[model samples]
Target: MPLILFNKPFQVMCQFSPHPSRPTLADHIDVPGVYPAGRLDADSEGLVLLTDDGRLQHDISHPLKKLAKTYLAQVEGTVTESALARLRAPLDLGDFTTLPCQAVRIEAPAWLWPRTPPIRQRADIPAGWLALTLTEGKNRQVRRMTAAVGLPTLRLVRIAIGPYALASHPLLPGEWQEVSPLEMR
Candidate 1:
């Protein structure tokens, strides 16, 4: 079973499962027999994996595999190095301490698309960019982590998963393509 990469746009659900009002993978990817290996929240966008192989799906989605996923997040508030340090450290989210991760503030790039329903903005308030990476993907982990550090995520985009990257397969919203790699690691 081969893998396909999709650049899931904001507001697109990760599965073929339909919502009463939102777009789904069925609306974007028409390939038969392929299913999403993992999920990205409808509010979050980018780098969704689809595969025909069940074992490959397990490898990518199961937390035990610990595949590294990297995200470029636009967050509300000026992110200080201290905040980055907090993200890097264990985050006691009551149930579990998030797996050790890396985060840092960087200049917001100009290439991102404007979200359909733009993130709420306060003229007096500021926002910054953060490049964050994690292994275990608990529910909304990045968002929760940012909120815990006092920087709410305004926009989130997964840039890469393991060896596959959005940079190599740049698809606009609602687009997908077959990854021609002979083998997946």
Candidate 2:
């Protein structure tokens, strides 16, 4: 089985097929018969697993599997302790309530790569970083949750899914490496 860890670049689509205006995994990966286990929005960037094993894919992507996915978010304004508390609590998104999640203020990740278009910032105000871990993969959940608590996410990156992480394999943006299925779990 082909198990790949791909560092998806900012503005790149998660799928293997070509897109008219945006880059896709096909531009970075040439390995045949592998599909992305889960999706990262074009606006988000980071680790994405690609695999040919259906069981492995299901394990990683299925919401019922309750695998943890970690994100590093850069938000406008310094995140207040109260806001952090709200983020850690179960959030009501109206469509559905989110499961309790881990949220904490973090320093800017020392290892993060430069975003291509770059995140615009105010000369007067400083942005803050937060490390958030969630089990459910709701549509734009991190962004929405932060917005609900008065911190708008300016940039987002998915750093890990389950036990797999970009650091373990050490991939730069748009790079990919094959790993064993055991590494995914």
Q: Give the C-alpha miss distance for residue 88 in model 2, angstroms.
A: 0.9
RMSD of 2: 1.1
lDDT of 2 by residue, 1-185 (tens): 98888989999988877899998999999988999998999999999999998999999999999999999999998899999988888989889888999999999988899999999989998799999999999889999999999889999999898988877778899988888798656
Clash pairs for candidate 1: none
State every prediction's TM-score relative to the real structure: 0.95, 0.96
lDDT score for residue 72 of model 1: 93
Candidate that scores best on TM-score:
2
Model 1, residue 55: distance off in Å is 1.1
Which residue segments of model 1 deviate by more than 4 Å?
181-183
On residues 59-150, what C-alpha lDDT tens digit does candidate 1 reach at each position?
Answer: 88999889999999999898898999999999987777898898878888677777778888899999999998899899999999999999
